[model samples]
Target: MTETETAAQSSIWTDEPFDVHAEDPFDRGSFVATVVRRIQVATADDPSTVFGLVGPWGSGKTSILDRVRSGLGDGWQIADFTPWSSGDAASMSLEFVNTVADLLGEKAAGEHRAKLAGYAGFIAPLLGAIPIVGSGAQGTAEHLLDAIGSRPPWHKQFADLSQAIQTLGKRVLIVVDDVDRLGGSELLTLLRVVRLLGRFRGVHYLIAYDQDTVEDLLRSTGSVGRSAAFMEKIVQYPFETPPLPRAAVIRLLNGVLEELLAKTDSHLDHLGLQRATSLVDALAPQLRTPRALGRFREHLNAFADHVSTARLDLLDYVAITWLRLNAHGVWSQLDSWRHELRSGERATSLTETEKLTADIWEGRIAEAHPQADRTGTLDVLSFLFEGVDVRERRTFIKHPRAMNDPTYFERYLLLAIPEDDVDDELIRIVAAELDPDKFREAATALARVLDGNDDALANLAISRLTVFRENYTTPNLLLLQFLAERMHVRVDEAERVGSPRNGLRPLVAREMALAVLAGETSAPDIIEMFGETEALNAVWMAPRFAEFRDRRSDLAEGFARFWADRLRSEPGAYIKGGRLGGVAELVTFALEPEETNGLLDPAVTDYDSYIDLAEGFVYAAEWVGSSYTYELQFRKDAFRSLISASTLERYRPQVLEHSGKVEYDVEGHPSRDIPPEIVKAFTVDSLSAL
Candidate 1:
């Protein structure tokens, strides 16, 4: 009823050929004019001329014939013959003769119509007398000759028709299309009939076919090198279809893309127009014809409707879709590459099979797209598989930039990983869990269905927790914590969530504790599962918890006390096992507004312990000064308390000297610089107090 509804109902890509008389979208009118002129010139010189229009399948041969017929106007009588639709050679011959007679009879009146019917009668008996038609062919031919009483043979009758056509001052143009679609026997029979019946003086023939295929068919009759000679004898003038222009093809493709985007409910802004332009440029050389562009649209229509919700990179999705349609072997190899990249062994180090598969895929690309730039095409492959080394053999490693980007990683999984790897039911369960409104319901439903008997589902749910971590929305984080809690409950009941030998309880528990600490979802529940020490340990290792700690000091202090107790019980372990690094990180999280200055007394273990405490205090001071500023005076007082007058005198010169150096060779050391102003503040504050 509405304009939008009407537009949506129209298809973006139709499988049918374009209408012959429609406006030319590809600027093909110039070529059509040239072809029409050539046909007219040849037919004017000799009315019996046969013109052959040669082109590949789906290369607009039929459209060209229609244009040529239209260009000829009322000067000639045109009989359009579709030989392929006739089913058999005999039927095709009959259709051709009957169509011409009808056209001619319609043009002529009274006496001329009677003359044309007389010629048609003479040809009918001869056509029936052909051996392929039926039995009693010789008797029927003899009887027809006797009845006519010395009437000329069928060829003589056709000559009379040609003479009658000339006398009537009319030229007949017979257009035959898709001759290559016929079988070998049917093709030979049709050619023979055309050579015989199409030789009238005032009649011209325009036949269309793929020359290479017809030549092959002729060669199969043992003609070998003489097939070209046979074609020359049949056709007076031959024209090969020219290559469609690249710019024209791209313009047509863009039109199709715009239509598809308009019809679908997708976030089109995410499909970067610049990247799509680059991809279209890359694909232009391979899409040599209009039909190739149509096929690409068909494949895109099938796969790209869900791209907005799937959150796939539009460039990567288009590249993969192109490969799936054009180069199937390369697509299969890329799927395998995705599988290996997800595997633990290949993630850490490349395997022999992965190396071989990459090489095979490169070779296939070269073979399939010889005209395309190999390096540029492989760049698309590199986008999908980060570790692919298209140039060198031994230096294959994942690109660090792509490995760290979450968007690129998500696209790789969405496109490369097969649906069967994670069953549809499991994927549905995961998707439902990720929804904000459905989070609680999906979690409860999964807990009921997979409490004890479904370890596989539980493990799948656990494995996908990392996927949700990248989506740092509040609702998504809450759902991540909820799913982790459900899995922990299952593990607590002694259910086999993972392999018995590996025991998934510890891994799931660690993830669950980290989720609570980073999400600040259920701190007490986290402490119950991993106990106080292990819970604090897991939180210490998790990244991006500054916001969580800033808002929840009560939870932060509980973890900090657990860390302090561990340091007190095993002071020697803190020095020997390099645990001071962990202590430094924990102190930063535990620093609060109320009691920040008093927390450092627990760090006094020994004389050397004072240096570690001062480092931890300086790190925490820098963190608070840069990140947290709610109570600035209290944080400054906390920094002065950790370093007394004597301790400041002891460490100030060492800290300043280390900071002055341009570079240091120490490995796994802190690289953050403590501002000299903070150290000077500590000394001046102590002097002021004195």
Candidate 2:
């Protein structure tokens, strides 16, 4: 769909506002209209009533304020000034009076404006507001206005101004907005001044402020405690505003999405606002309440391109919706389907059977994008598998990842996983595929299924590889050593093995850990890599070090000492530089270092990231009992996560298990000789991802 449409589709997911243009169909709709409704309600009378409007920092709070102030009803004085934006204390009282005078002129139309100017009297000079209206219009009006503005104890003129406003209306409601934005002294002045002004009895100072401001003041300046000492001195009623309710928020989501969708027909067209509304309602808790609906509004509009075109196919659209609907389903965990399949008395036999079928397809997806995970697959997979008659357990290879297609996972893993609603059909496809032999065949069958052109699986195939038993067995041992050395951890003594990263990224330092799983990088690499004093010192106080410190402080400290020594020798590490852009990126992906990005000079633009990619001239010195392949046998083999033949078959009879035939059970099930422990250990869900 077009860019405008994707918004309608995504709108159901969130309720936040977006940047719809002035001309968009939803711009003037009931959704936005409601936000302004409260403003109008308070401003509609001859004498406006006091009300508070609060929202997040960037949530268009000021826009509502501006609209209300401009459109307030006739014969009402509005004294609204945001002193916080200017960041000054002295000018605040003066600016407030100017606004009050302006409002008085607007409310009176033309009657008392000149009369008001004449009355600024002794209040003018003291408050410093008179010269602002007329340079030297020296009289009681000027003097009084300035006096009131500068706050020079002008009880008489202040009461006079309030009484004059009351003559125009029953009472003057001073709308002091955004007082929360001002710093220290300005805030105190506003509260104190407004409190003193309220002494006129009928007038009210309506204000809105973040609780954080007052809370911070209480924390830093003991305002809360100090104010308690003077509690009796202040006479007033305090009605703290309550937060918006849950159901009202859902209504807010509906109003916004329904209104926004009317623009391009994507939301209503693709998922129907009803279902969209349902999805949004369900997300309140996950979206973190308060402004959930508003954020939905924003996210919806952002992906407008995806939503509008979604209207073309009803099944595809609903299928997509169903996935999001069941986002927290089986695909949420690797053992979910197995856990259910293994369950009996309460199990949905037909349900389990159907879900099992979907899993067969999932295994292919896993094989295809070995790097991918099962999250997000239920949506598209549910749609694709929904109509696929699973009674006979027929197999078909649709886009993988059970809920999300392989294409989505490739992109998703590079970022964070979006919480998706999932569909049931995904589990069915996976169940049938999990029957080892069938799963293996179906996975291999995909090469023929797509005729090798499935666009979604194309990128995924880079990690999905076929292993020949003849070429695998004992030949690939060096890969194990290589992996072991790099990870700073040991690989088992067992010679050879294989794995893939097809669709999603590896989890838990998995980029580096996958090498360990595939026998390419060792755990020791992690240990020894950190053992470098120079490398350790380079990254000691960085924020990314937080997780590394928390998770494995022992390893991190070793690297810290190693780096300290390394840096001490050089004294100027990065200043004595070599390119590290790739190392920076790779390590970032691997270690997630928060503060490791030592900046480069603005002029040095062409940075290479391959600082450690140099092919094996080992950095260890002889003192560490490490010789240059003297006693050690060095193999001239290139390392890759996936298994290969030439590199393996030469060393051992076979480097990995590449045989087409593994012994099968009578029912054609692949032998569990592969070991459930091994299968279980091979997490379809990588922990590193979380």
Candidate 3:
């Protein structure tokens, strides 16, 4: 496999506890060393002692115990007791007693082993009929039975085991981990074994558990006193695990995120890094332990694999994945609330209804997660989405790569872009290109993506360009020229393609070109640049630029007429498969009365050319209220600018031949071409002939 392929499969983080000093990011080793020294002093003074290592779940309790065990000298014998492995109280008592005996017997030599077995024999018959659960337990049970054939009274047996432990001259440390995992009766039984039955001279107990969990279990077991009082009686010297510093947790989190970025070949820019730091700060309260950080890392790994991380805003990706893992209930409703969230992104953009909805979601999110720190989660939500709290007005410049942007919002939530939507990476490639030819080529290629002859992607692309408009260069002017001619085709594509988030407008291309030129050059300079170009779009642009001198100046009129005359020079550009929108534009802004009449004239002999001309009178009516009463209508008002009423008399035979093919229902909905309304309107006009 290639190196790149191998790197993709490798993991950069793990949740396993650190076993060595160097791997201890929490400075736990020093604490462990102190614990070890304290145990040595406490055990030297008393033959048997119980020390409780206390913390909440995932707070590294086991790690501390492991370190303390390693810190002890060779003279110490360690026996790990896992009470959860046993099914009942009897099993737990029996297994624990045997564990101590086996530890002593295995290390003791010659007469010491015999003496250890003799001591174990005293307690063998007392623990009645509990099934042996391990090989060590079986061996210890047999050794105890063989060493002493007869059983003694309970007190005498307890005394014998205690004396034997004192005489062995070896220090024993019994480490019990995750004691809180045991059930009610089992937990009470294990505590009884430690404090009463199994307490022997020179044997020390280091019990690790979450104190809150242990106390809660003790209460459920019908303990007579307060849970803390019972725990205090059993655990003489209790040490609570220190709370993890918020700064340390964030530092560790940052290091892990940086490693993940490197592993995925993704990097954050200065702004991205700043946003990430702020998000981490906001998220620190929930990320209270190494285990929580590990969970975040796991989520990040899955996100990196599932989506194109390089194309997303790093801050948004990290924030979203973290929210999904930690605040699942709120995350579940994000897609449904996308519209409100998007409108809320800018305070000025929100309506009163949307503002009310945002307030409702804020309260709802906090109510849904009552156990969470309400203010902290709300703060994170505010940071994640600007619209979540319009009153705060946390304004920032919007970017198309942000998950909160309406255009890319679905891509973030779904982890894939829609077919008609252009990817941000593709936009970046065109934006970054410096060479004029290459940039225009890339932009042209983007323009070719259409949905059944409608320029869907081009509309979406131009809408997304607002975010990257500041990155435009002199070479980007070519894009302006390219879009100018095609803007008419892309006008209604956003609606047709069902991309409401595109937010397209009729003059978006013209406005975008003006924006691109705001700092680079003046309006007159654009005329100088494209003055000699043969491109029709350039000719269309020249008059718009000339308007800067005066809206109706002679210079602007000349430029408008020049565009119309140029169109007259090349009639096929309009007559052959061309959009009629161009001719409407010329009549509105570029043509004189005579020139409009001349340009509107087309070949009536050829069927294709005649149909193209006839289409100027055909129109598809939009829905009124809810229903479209007239599917197709032909109105003379649509042709008023292009042709005079007198001119219509010249095409009487052509209109009649096409009008004879008309078909429609009584309500005037056409099945196909040749609108019936055209024949009705034409006959009425002929009766009152000019």
Per-residue alpha-carbon lDDT of candidate 1 for residues 249-349, written as tens digits (9 for 90 to 100): 77766665665566455334533565456556667776766677667877776666545445444555666777666666555555445554333124334
Q: Which stretches of candidate 2 lie over 4 Å from their true place?
A: 1-75, 106-153, 167-170, 197-202, 224-281, 286-291, 304-408, 413-690
TM-score of each: 0.62, 0.36, 0.67
- The per-model lDDT (C-alpha) reads 0.55, 0.36, 0.59
lDDT of 2 by residue, 362-397 (tens): 554465445343323422443333232233432222
The weakest ten consecutive residues by lDDT in model 3 span 500-509
**Which prediction has the highest lDDT against the true structure?**
3
Ranked by lDDT, the better of candidates 2 and 3 is 3
Model 2, residue 641: what's the lDDT?
Answer: 13
- In candidate 3, which residue pairs get closer than 3 Å at backbone N, Cα or C atoms, i.e. clash? 47-202
Measured on C-alpha atoms, candidate 1 has an lDDT of: 0.55
Summarize candidate 3's per-residue lDDT along 545-664 as a digit string, tens digits.
433334333323444465455455664554443334444554445455665664555434454454456554454555454544545444444355555555566665555555534344
Scored by lDDT, model 3 comes in at 0.59
